[model samples]
Target: MSATQTAPAAASPSPASAPVKNSRGRVILASLIGTTVEFYDFYAYATAAVLVFPVLFFPTGDPLTAQLASFGVFGAAMIARPLGAVVFGHFGDKHGRKATLVASLLTMGIATFIIGLLPTYAQIGWFAALALLILRLAQGFALGGEWSGAALVATENAPAGKRAWYGTFPQLGAPIGFIIANGLFLVINFSSPSREWFLEWGWRVPFLFSAVMVIIGLWVRLKLVESSAFEKASTKGAIRKVPIGTVFRHHWKELILGTFFMLATYVLFYLMTSYTLAWGIKPADVETAQAAADAAGTPFDAAAFFPGGGFAYPEFVTMQIIGVVFFGVFTMLSGPIADAIGRRRLLIWVTLAIIVFGLTFNVFLMSGGSPRFAGALAQAFLIFGFTLMGATFGPMGALLPELFPTNVRYTGSAVSYNVSSILGAAVAPLIALALWAWVGEPWLVGVYLSVMGVLTLIALIIGKETKDVDYEEAGFSSSAVL
Candidate 1:
């Protein structure tokens, strides 16, 4: 009797008898598919904001004014994200991750699909821009909850010692979604009979097509069981009556640290995707830009204009896609490296590298003396920037949520992540454009990125390492922790 041992938890557990565990594949698919749809919808809107929305929705007679207006609408969504975070996080932290994720996906998908159907400024006057703003806010709201849920679903379910590695699955969605969305846009651009028709009808395809991906994501996510960490928190009666209140009262320091931890990532990501596209694709010479404006029937004011790097849309997109391939690869690579070392240690080095990289933007971008030379420099810049993007971004999937305890993980992480979105993502493109025009080059934009990185590094130095934190560790039950 003294030597007899009780059976392990799995000794008598069968598929039907035991608790429903989220399999690796199911967890990966659920997290990956949700964010894929989320980012795809986001990137499609971002691309359209740069390419079509300025002309179709703003139509302000001045290219820069119209572009700035479009970015204003774009930034509106970021403003709504924290609200979405609070609402969604309340449900997620108290109820479960699966339902919150499904709700977010549905919200984003429907908003995007409706955007495809909205009338342009040419047809509905300013109402069209108003409708676009509303829909963009909905997208932002859905995304606020979507990311934290997905990251938690992945990392909380991960086997011991592999949270960072598993976290990359959802992070992978960024590059995959970007490629698919942009690839489809490129196809529409090539296949359309006329530029006018493409501008009018083709831009709607990606937004409308989000419906299909949303359906697929729903199917995958519906199969997910609530994560074990959430179950344990619930079992221990640690589920707070209001999770965000607990987070604010007890975890305020982590909340601040997590927000800045993500500041550089948001700034760098938007700069790479949105700012660079606007900066790289415009003609550097006024004559070509004016001629292009004339061909498109858009009004141009050459006397007050500043031109861009002069790369054709297809050439630049191909270059960006190539760089994004590096983005996807390095994203996968960063996980193991972070896991093998530690998230804090690896990101410190990457942050320093980002700081250095940002200082050198003028070397590649401003030195485009000849067409051939310019193309090479631009492509190199895209590659290096996006490579840094992947490395910095991949770790965030684990880093942000790990800052909080299980009971308030969703609320804390979402608030932190989305609040940073307001500071960084919402304003990066607009600020970059103004800086590019004011200073007459892209160097200030690079300095903008470096400053953000420096802030992020300072936060990292102040914050503690999250790699050693246990996802399933006991959570606070309306209690204080030092």
Candidate 2:
């Protein structure tokens, strides 16, 4: 008998049996919590890179170079993601989603905790920077494995006819994590006495708090059962022999489509989060070093005077944190909206909005006014941009898994998602930094979003719509031979 024929009937459950209260809800909760913790760890680094790292790790005399170096470290995680996807996805397909989900969370938590404890550049010289880099790469590896398992958990447990709607649950982690990550920093920024006080201790609080989030994520994930589809695949020995190779050999087209389709989403994310924070600092009234100089009576050059060592101003940190909360609110609304409207249609519209908004973000920053007004504009832009991101990002939970078959779905979806991370999301801040420095005009960064948006549009136009497709029957078949 074929491997497909060897499993219990639950392996092929109909839509009615897969209701939200059944196995479906348990799987969605597990996947959502796991991804939330992973993103919390990952995005916390992005927040730190913008607000603290240039002062802490790379203390070059030139502010621009130091900031770029900080962003370079931020980009390192994306570069490591694809490699992680292959390694973890291979095992996830062969072993199961539960194992990979658990391992990825533990790895991310350990790396993030180490980041909280690392000695400053002053204490260990170059070693502090080295430690941060190693930890960032580990975070990347963990994230790489994270999405595949989370997505599979949702897709596999979803009701047959409404998988797209349920699968989107894991995707909610992006915005929810964004909310918690930024909200914690906002609290820290507001609580500090002087900007100097904030830079010295405020930034570390968010990274340190990650231990609690990971614990919660682990507890929830531990309760999850193995995905019904994967359980069946394992019983029959139909899991891809060499998953990545199998994907590359047989389904390269879908992989490529998935990569481009995801590019606009990723780029817009980094632009809104990391790039927006960078722009806010360079142009706003807050002296990144004002707090240290006020107390020390020395002219504080931020690149020369790292935080944890000291800071220049404090009020501005609160403003930035407020802006992040706006981002979180929009993310919360995206999942259900995508379920209501198809993923493809929503993504196309949102891609266009990002292209337009990316350009407008710089315009608002460059236009002069009281710092308060600029802060308001910044908040509005971030909220609006993240709103569109939520809309399209909502659907990807279902869309990716629906693109591939059960046998190699884990591997294929992972490659597609991580490859998009490397190409679009991971490199975005670095690209934005380079463009801003190279031309002295941040608007050019919008051009980057526009190009990717156009590509996403084209890809979606040519792609299949999986809104109603049966999960078991999605994507192409893998031949028994590799």
User: What TM-score against the true fold does each predicted structure earn?
Assistant: 0.93, 0.85
Model 1, runs deviating above 4 Å: 1-15, 283-306, 477-482
| lDDT tens digits, residue span 172-212, model 2 | 78767877887787777767786677667778888889889
Q: State each model's C-alpha RMSD to the native.
A: 3.7, 6.7
lDDT against the true structure, per candidate, is 0.87, 0.73
Instruction: Write candidate 1's Cα lDDT for 1-482 as tens digits.
Output: 33235555436576676688989999999999988998888789888987778777787888789889998889889999999999999999999999999999999999999999999776777898999999999999999899999999999999888898999999999999999888988889789776667667989999999999999999999999998889999999989999889989988988898899999989999998888888777643446445545665556554344267778676787888899999999888999998999898889999998998888878878845889999999999999989998999999999888888899999999999999999999999899999988988889889999999999999988877778876776568322221
Model 2: lDDT of residue 223: 78
As for candidate 2, its clashing pairs are 55-306, 195-313, 195-314, 289-312, 290-312, 291-312, 291-313, 292-311
